[model samples]
Every structure is written in C-alpha cells, then in structure tokens.
Target: MTDLHRRNPYRLPVLLLIALSTVVGLSILWEFRLEAWVMHWLALPYDADFEDAERWRFVLTATGFSLISMLIPTIMLRRLIANTRSSYRRLKQAQAKTETLATYDSLSGLINRRIFMEMVRNQLGLKRPAAVMLIDLDHFKAVNDQHGHAAGDIVLVEIARRLEAIADDNGGVAVRLGGDEFCLLFLKFKHQTELGQIAEAAVFQLSAPLSSAVEPSALGATIGISRSWTDAQDASALLHCADTAMYRGKKDGRSTYNFYDSEYEKQRRAQADLELALRRAVEADEIVPFFQPIVALPSQEVVGFEVLARWPKPDGSTAAPADFIPVLERLGLIPAMTRSLIKQACRAANRWDDHLRLSMNVSAGMVTDALFPDQLLEQLRQEHFAFHRFEVEITEEALVGNLEVARQNLSKLHEHGITVALDDFGIGYSSLYHLTRLSIDKIKIDRSFFEPGQTDHLPMVEAILGMARSLKMQVTAEGVEEFHLPHLPSWLANSGCNYAQGYLYGRPKPASSLFCYTHSSFAQQAG
Candidate 1:
C-alpha cells in the first residue's frame, strides 16, 4: 500500500472516500433503532411504536441518500485531482525541454560552453583534480571550402558522436565549444599520464574520415590538455591554458596534443606579437622583394634573378624569411603579401634586359586560389611585363592541397607563356610524383644534396639530373655556397646542371644592386 501511495500520489482522495462511506453506514444504523433508545434516555420524543419492517425501510432509504450526497463531491474531487496531476506532468516536461535547450548544443547534442563551464566550476569547488582538453580540427576550412558547409556539418556531427561515446566510456563530459572546436572534461583524474591517454584516444577518434555524401577526406585534430591542480584552479584559467597548448600543437604541425607549459605560453605570446607586426608590415608595404642572381653554370654569367621577400624592420635591419614567412602563411597573409611583392617584382623586372628572366616564389595559399593565374596575368599586363621572361617557382609543399587546382593553375600559367619550376626538389616524398604530374619546365635541386660529407646524396643528384635530361627539363643546382672550393663548380657543371644560385655568387640584394651587378658582370665578361 505504501509503494502504491508512493507511485500514485492521488491516493489521498480514495482514502477519504472509504472513510466517508463507513460514516454513512453508521448513520443509517443510528436512524434504524439506536437513535430511538438514545432519545428515550434523554427524555426526548421517539417513534418506538413504528413496525420493524418500516424501520428497516427507513435504514435503506437513509443509506441511499447519504451515498448519493458523498458520490457527487467524491467525483468532483477526483476530477480536480486528476487535472492537477496532468498540469504538474506537463510543467515538468516543459521545464526539461527548456533545460535541454539552455544546456546543450542544438546540432551536436553535446553540452554547450556555458553549461560546460558550470560543470568545471562545480568540480573545482569539490577540490577534485581534473583535466580539461581543447580540441581544434585541423584544415577544417579546407574541408568546408572543398565540400561545402553541409558536408562540413556532417563531419562535425560525426565527430561529436564519437566524442560523446568516448566521454561516456570514461565518465567524462564532452562539449561543443562552437565551430570546429570541442572541449572534454575528465573528472577525478589520478595522473597526467591518464589524461594524456584519453587525449590521444580523442585525437585518434576524431581523425577518422566522416561519413558524408560528398566523399569527405580524412580529418585531423590537435588537442591541448591542462590539469586543474597543475595548470589552473579555475574554469577560465584552465580553458585558457588548454587553448594555449592547443595552438602550440597546431604550430608543431597539428594532429597531436600538447600539455600546458609556461615556456610554451611565453613563446605563443611572442609569436602572437610577430603575427600582429607582420599584418601591419604588409599593410604599410614594409615587405619588399630582394633579387638574387641566378647565374649560368661554368661561365658564371648572370642569366636572371629570383625574387626573395625581406621584411625591413624599423632599425633598417631585415627580418629573416625563415622567421616571418611561416607566420605569414599561418595568418593567411601570404596571398596578399605575394600579390604585393609580385607587382613590385614585375615592375622592376620590366626594366631589365629583354633576354633576362625574373622568377618569383608562389606561396601555397596563392596556388590554391582558383583565380590566381588570371589575377597574376592581369597584374603582369598592367605592368606591361612580358610573360615569356617570367617564371613562378613552387615547392612540393605548395601542392599539398587540391592537386587538381594546382595543376589547373599551372596549366593556365604555361598557356600564357610563363615558365613553372619545381623548387627544393629531393626534400619531399612526392617530388618525383609532382614532377611527373605537373607541367614543370625546371627542377631546382635542394641545398641538402650539396652539403659537404653528404656524398651519399651525389648519386641521387646524378639520378635527378639524368631524369631531368630525359624529360627535356632544365635543372638548377641551388645553394652552391662552396663555389670558391677547387673543382666544386666544375663538378656541378660537368654533372649536367644548367643553372646555379647561391651565396657564392651574392646574397639577395635590392633590385638596384642586382641591376648594377648584372651590368658590371656582363661588361666584364664581354671585355
């Protein structure tokens, strides 16, 4: 009965009906005979002369009247109780729906940022050690660009499902913290090692290819981990720490996880400052092109120039290309910077001898632009630069994305009489593949093959030259810094390399310096 009452809280009305029915029965009995005796004892008038059968008839009539009176109120009360119960149930359901909307992501069905933070704060209040992770999808923008936002959404939803499963298995909470980023909170973690294991699992799981209608490519994620006891004590601090580590992971080439460290944070801030300065530099046109002479082998005659980028600081010193180019790429400023430098280079190169060519490096971002060839050709026409005397150089890294796009862009360049050269050959795994696939006119052997004591690379270099010869392509031996050494230049010349460029001839200089060098060198050779 107690269990039944607990299940059905409306049992109070039924108990009241039972008590009322018993009272009605006893009242009927009193009217039958008991009330007559009581009336005589109290010296009141009583109907004792009536027959027994008449008295029984009165008992039944009284019982029927009492039951009728009780039945009306009981029915009304039951209806009222039932209505109240229904309203309460609907109210509870509405509250649950509101709570779901407020606390969870509508798309992924994972906890949203606000509720995730609340959970982190509650865990902190309990003084328990925990781990917080920030995961960022690598190259997600490319996925969206290549396959459209619908496909990207499918990938995100699948990733969320996988994360949710992992969280359930580990007793953790997963959150979709907007866009292609997610957060995981692991409670009562005993050690950082365990946290690392969980993070690796997440990385592996998220890296899987999504089931999308667009034939989605494999995706990778970078994870950043922070422990509450070690990295931070509060929710915001913990998230910040994890975010810092996540960016570090991205900088280190993504698809991995990094633990929060003070040193990494310091480096991250410095990189941030550099990125800001680069943006300003590009806007101010502080970035300029410096020309390096590419000399013909054996004769050492200046044939053409390669345009290199240099960032001139306020102190009149130049920032190293190695220092700023990667940052520029990361900031998505490479395309803009390339455009500016190309315009300047073209205008300067137009003043050179008609026979001399000018070569400039095209960044990966630029090649990925579908309209890059058109834009470049239009810029060349605006500068009145001859397309036959221009070349664009790209490395294997430039072809890492959208090969078909790269090939199409190169084809457009070739059709317009511009030369394409594959730079830094032998450094990438796909160098030979690229050579076979792209319509390249030249292959520039990387500097590593020319380093001293790397004699083992000589055979490979010979093989590359042989391959270039078979394909009727020109080969440039880059990084010829030891030209002064006896027999080095002659050895390269004898090895069938047609062109060379390196510190041995001259470091990269301004266009004016290069023009003077070209003029004086040709005059000397003629004399």
Candidate 2:
C-alpha cells in the first residue's frame, strides 16, 4: 500500500463511504413519501394545491438533515481512524528507538557487546583471515575519580570517535565493550603487519591529551591484536586472545600494542587460575603473615618485625608475594586482604615483647581509602595491640597519584601513635617530595643500594642516611645478606642507621617460629 493508505487504512474510509452513499440514496428515493407522512403525522397542511417552491424547500431540507445525521458518524469514525494510525506509527518509531538503544552504546554510539559479538561470529563463519583487537584505557578510573565522571565521559566519547573514524577508514568495525574497554574487528587484513600498524595508530591517537571541562588529562591506550588464522577459529576465543594480549600490553606499559603469543597466553591462563585460587585463599584465611626481624644495627638485636603475606599451598609450598600482590591490587582485593592480614599480624604481635614493634606493609588502595586509618586502629584495638608498637610501611609508588590524600592518611596514623615508614625509599620519583610532605617516621633504604660491587651507590646511600638523620627519621638498611654483612662498611653503623633487615638477619618466619625468639635471652645472644 502507498504511504497515505498505510497511515489511514482504506477499510474504515470505504465502510463509511458505503454507509453514507446508501443513506443518501434511500433518502432521495423515498423523499416525497417520507415528507408527506411526516406532515400528516404532525397534522400539518399537505394540500394538493400547495406552492411548488414551499414543497420543494421542505423536501430539500428533510434530505439535507438526513445526510448531515449520517455524515456525523463518518466524520467521527474518520477522526478515530486517523488517531489510531498516528498512535501506531509512534509505537513503531518507539520500538525502533528501543532496538537501536539495545544495539548501540548510549555514551559512544558504538555497537554494543552483543551486536559486536554477533558480527564476530558471522565473520568467523566465513573462515577467512581477520584481526581482532582489544583496547583498554590505562588509569581511566583515576580520571573518573579525580575529575568526576563527566570528564571521564568526555574522554571516552573522544576516544570512541577516534576509534570509529580509524575503523571506518580501514573498512573495519569498532565497538565499546564497556567502560574504558573497546574492541575493533577488521574482516579484511593482508598481514599481521597491517594489523599491527592499525593498532599502533589507535594507540597513538588515544595517547593524545583529552580535553575536559575540569582539566586536560593525558591518557594512553593499550591495544591487543589477534589474528583469526593464527589465534582461533571462533569469536569468543579470538576475543579472549585479544584480551590476553591487551593485559600483556598493559603490563609492558601502556600506549603500545602486543600480538597474541602462545607463551603469553599460557602465562595468562596460569595467572587467571592463580587469581581464582588466591581469592579462595583469602576467603579461607589461608593467607598468613610471616614476620622478618628488623634488628638494631651493630648489636644485631631484634627490635621489631616486618609482617609479610604468604600464601601457602596445600602441598606446603608458598606462593611469593611478588606473584600474587599485583593480581590482588588489579582486582581491587588488596584492601580486604590487607585488613585480614593486619588483624592477624596484630594478634600475633600480642605474643611478642611490648618494645618489639610489628610493621605491616600497606597497599596503595588501603592508603587511599578514607577509612583506612580508622580501620587499622579498630583492628589494633580489637586485638589489644599497642599503637606505639605498630608501624605501617607504605611504598613511595603508592603515594604518587594522590599525595595529599595519602599524606592526610599518614598524618592520622602518626596522630594515633603509629609509626609510618617509607618502604623501598629512594626508588620512586617522588621520594624526596614524600619525605618533606608526609609525616614519615622511618625510611627503609632499598636493597638495590646494598648490592655488592656497587660502591657507586654508597655515596647515595650515605646521602639518604644524612637526609634521614636531618629529618630525625629512623633509617633501616635492607637486603643485608649474610655474604654482604662482613663487607659492610663502618659508615653504615656509624651514620646512625637505626635498623637493618634481610636474609642475613633471618628469613621471614611464621609466627610459631618467631615465638621461639621471643625470650629475652635470644636478644642477649644476638646482641
């Protein structure tokens, strides 16, 4: 049917026309008879000699009234049909809008995950060479948290536009897979090099500064590329390959692209499995604190212990913190893990001498948490742990992003009589700044400075000692292996380095083993 008939169906108009035509024809056919009957019934004059003009006028008036009465219903029906047609059109438009919304991302106007995956499945069925890339924005949550989500949204929109343009130019498809994550699918690619070049271009484009109302922020993108022929034959597997590569790109540092490799994929699967196991370990309280003694220099007497997390497998082998800590941080599980470990450490510290301090490392997320100080204090209180005997160790890297907030949190810890130590000092760019800005009570010189044959680093170490002395902050020389102790120069002891900790002093021991050294004679023997 044509547009007009579609808008207003012919059935209603045809029925009304037929009814109106029938009424008019019948009225005309019996006009004189009906008029005479009406006049006789009303007892009005119906003389044979009546004027022709009067009689004709009466007949015409009667026929016109009958036609008007029939046309009223037709006009009403026509109006009802027009209204129904309008509502139907609107309903269809609304449904089309809803479908568009379901398939497209509202913020970026890119194809959503569902539609993109469907397209990928179709492409995979062709069994032809193609490339899939996963793109993730690095440190995007910081932008949203610092500048507000509006600024983050602007950045996302800009990145989406760039990706869409690039994909269109290359005859590819771009999709937003969620916050700060996107996917690009290229159905026709000659070689991996072509895909690599396209991925590189996307990274470069995304690395540009994003303009926002709050402020301009520098953001970088990491892209992971996977080829259909080499990576996988299915859509889900292809996307997984790309995702795995993207994470590797992130680990290698942002603003880069990485192609899928079997080795990396294997490592990725292992890491994923380890993460799952770690989560279970956290829930089951399998993560325990192992204490490494921090000794007073020269005397070799244990004055305090630094608590370290150890995840012991069922087979009695322990997973190294280096292997699982990053995963915890990435998954935002560090805060919960830290809280659990802190309580355990505080309880264990109760078995030690009041003068022997217990030190625990604080993750970046914990320090940023506004309630961290309160939580720590509450845990200590519940454990009946003395605040003065507790030290909180934080890395310089943790305080990089929000220095003011970290400083505030550190100040609160200091106010509660808890010692704040800067762990792995002299490594990060903001070391000096942290020393000046934060209320740090101790600085642990990194082990890198203590490596043998590194006389060049002695001067820097001495400088760090001097700076710490000037600030009246205690200093700990770390990485004091047994082999290096004899080679340790007298300056370290004389320069007022308050403590030393490493394998030389003793490896990290469980709380049960540490109890063996709790007696006063152990300190006397070591001294």
Candidate 3:
C-alpha cells in the first residue's frame, strides 16, 4: 500500500528467481564444479543433451517455482504476528481485573477488610498517633422493619459511599466489613469523624443530607477508636483492639464514639448485660411513670404536674433518662413506654381536681400513630380530664419534619380541645417560623435562655415574644432556679407569656406532698 511496500512487494521473489536462473545457467556451462555435478546428477546414466533449449527452460522454471513457494509464507506471517500481540494484550487486561477484585469489597466496592488490615500492618512503622475507628449503624434492624429490606440495602450502600469519601485520601482508608458495619483508618485526627475537613469536601456531591434519610435521630453515627499501645504491631491486633473499643461506644449510648479504656471496657461489658436485662424489663412491666408537680411561678401553687418515666431497678437509686432513653429507643420499647404512660397519666388526671392539668412528654411521632389517637381518646373519656387542660410538650427540632402532616394531626387533637405546646422554642433555626404556621397554643422558653452571664439575646427574645403575642400564644419560662430572673413578668405580660414553671417557684414534688401545699396558697395564684 505504501511506496516502500509497493516497491519491494516482489523483492524476495525477484532475488530468489535471479539466484535460481544463475545456478541453472552455471550448471549448463563448462565450469569445473558445475560440469562435474551436472554430468553426475542430470545425465542419469543416459547421454543427455548438454544444452537443450527446452530442457534448459524446464530446469530454470522448476527452480524458480521452488523459490516462489518459500516466498508465499511471508504474507501470512505479518497477520499472525498482529493476532498474537492482540491476544497478549487481552490476557493482561484479565489479569488486572483479577488483581482489582482481590483488594476491593465485592459488596460496597470499597477496600475489603483484608486489604485494610494489610495496609495497616504495612504502614504501622510510620510511627504517629493514628486511630482506627469502627462504626456500626444504630437501629439498623428497625430501619429494615420500617422501610423494608430493599430500602435498608440502599441505606447501607449510601453509607458506604459516604464513609469512602471521608477516608479516600491522605492517611485515611475506609473499609467495608459487610452489613452496616465499617472501619475508618484515621491517618490523622485532624477533624471530627464525618463532619471534619475531609468529609466536608465530599458532602457537596450528595443530593440529600446523608443522615436524615436513614433514621429518626438523623443518621447519627457511633464511633469507637483505639490507639496502638505497642511501639510496633501486626494488623490483626490493631483491628481487634479497635473493634473492641467500638462495641464500648455502642454501649455508651450510640451516636457517639468512645476511645478505648480498660475501666470503661469493663463498664461497657456490664452495660451490655444491663441493656439485655432492660429489654426484658420493658416486657415485664418493670418500667413505670412518676409525676412531679409544675406549680405556678408567683404564687408557688401547684396547678399541674409533669410525668417522668422511671425504671425501678433493684438498686435503691433510679436510672436517669439520659442513661436509658437511647437504650429504650434502640430496643424498640418507645411504643410500649408511650402506651404505658398514656394509660397511667390519664388515670391520675381523672382523680385530680377538675381545675388542675397534666403535662406528659411524648415523642413527636406519637401524635400521628393510628392507635395513639383512639387510645388517648379512650383514656381522656375514662378520666374525664378536660381536653383543654392537658398539654403535650415537644422540642422545636421535632416539629421541623413533616410540618404539614403535623398540622393535620394537631388539628385532630385541637378538635378535642387539647392544648399543644412547643418545648425548647428558641433552639431550632426555624422555630419561630414553625410556631406561627402551626396552630399551637403555647411555647416553652428553653432553659438555656436563663443561664447566668449569657447575653445579647434580647432582640431574639423580644422578637419571639412579639410573634407569640400577635398569635395570642402563651409563653412559659422553664429552669429559673436563681432568685433574680432575667426576663420580667412585664415583658412576658406585654408579650402575652402567662405561665412560669421551674425550681424557683417550687421543686417538682410528688402529688401527695404537693396537694396540701397548693390549695391554701391562693388557689394556684395568677401565673
């Protein structure tokens, strides 16, 4: 096709033919060796013509034919060479694929656990205070239950991607340990686990907030970290130690990570046993509700009581809400707790004076539950507690989700004349906006508003007061333990805040103890 190939296409054949013709001519002529060989071989026992033109032509043509036969093989040789090269390339590609899968997790497609261990083992000599974290998704079983297994599968995959981004570079490595469990090899603890500097760089690529789509607590993650104690170590011991530390974090109220401690490790083991026991106690009716009276501020007169849940441990002291709320929620006992408290609180409300009210804390979700509405109505009917007298306290952050759905649910309660209050009013970014939108009757100022030496919140507080006044919503200040309160009754009076409930008025006391002190003190003095 090219000039060189076209010019030399017959070069080998031409050279072969020339050599053959010369040899034939030389044999016919009187050259010593040619004459000797020709006479011996070609004579063949008969006197042959030394130079017969036809015989000469045949001999020369036959020699040329032999040379052409050898030259024909050269054409196929180039194609064979090309094919062999292509085959070699494909073989290399297949080998590469085999090597890739060896170190990558088949499920999440992140690095596999074996490779992770190998990396740590190889790099331990770098000698820095590195941390390896084990993270397990909290309440993964319930996610499977409420969202179905397919949704749960997606959750795990997305979680893998998120963690991969966090540890994709520098000293970090993210490995999938299968299921909802994962490990992050922290090359440097330069920032927080997921929200730190490296993770922030990765968040922009995701369409939805990673945490919220997964669970109620908003994709809260628990971390456990272990420091390599020995100057040198193998990967097996590092991973094992890190994993043990992680289990401790789960025991210490998941959604937080814990560093390894021998004393804390023992506490965690005992705590795991306690969590198992607590699950059974929830079934056995060992958890119970206790009431503390929330009295009027100025008069110190008991007007209503707030219900607090308790688990009567065999030990004399009680387990605080902080200790067990996470456990109960994780164990799927919140629904049971909700049911028990509703029944008990209604019974007490029925026995109380007609003028008094009862306040009970509920998960924001309890309001929408199909059974919740009917069960609550039945209790209210049985107790004859005026629908107007009961108040439901929910935090500001709880109200942000599904506001339209919440409005509809609240409308049903409003139809029964029940009062709903927003607790922790100023904590959320959109709290005031939500207050105006929902048909809430009251807002409770969060206790943080009263912390000593805190300043520069007058404008925000004033704006909140003005908005509540415009809507005719009553404001109740909580956690005023000091003798001198920061916000006055006049600003509250001007803003339509009517109730103040905290320790400054009176500490929460049992109903039996509070009843006698209340009536003679001016019939729940104008709060």
Best by lDDT: 1
Model 3: per-residue Cα lDDT at residue 228: 61
Q: Tens digits of per-residue lDDT for model 1 on 325-441?
A: 988887889888988888888878777776778898898878878999999999889988899888999988889988899999999999999999999988899988888888899
> Clashing residue pairs, candidate 3?
223-257
Displacement of the residue 281 alpha carbon in candidate 1, Å: 4.3
Which residue pairs collide in model 1, if any?
Answer: none
Q: What is the lDDT of residue 409 in candidate 2?
A: 94
Better of 1 and 2 by lDDT: 1
- Give the local distance difference test score of model 1: 0.85
Q: Name the best candidate (by TM-score).
A: 2
**Which is superior by TM-score, 1 or 3?**
1
Encode model 2's per-residue lDDT on 81-124: one tens digit a residue: 67887899899999999999999999999999999888888888
For all candidates in order, the CA lDDT equals: 0.85, 0.83, 0.66
Superposition error at 505 for model 1 (Å): 1.7
What would the TM-score be for candidate 1 when compared with the true structure? 0.57
**Backbone clash tally (model 3):** 1
Q: Please provide TM-scores, in order, for all candidate models, with all chains considered together.
A: 0.57, 0.64, 0.50
Rate residue 231 of model 3 by lDDT. 18
lDDT score for residue 159 of model 2 = 85
In candidate 3, which residue ranges exceed 4 Å CA deviation? 1-265, 296-300, 368-371, 382-384, 454-460, 485-495, 516-527
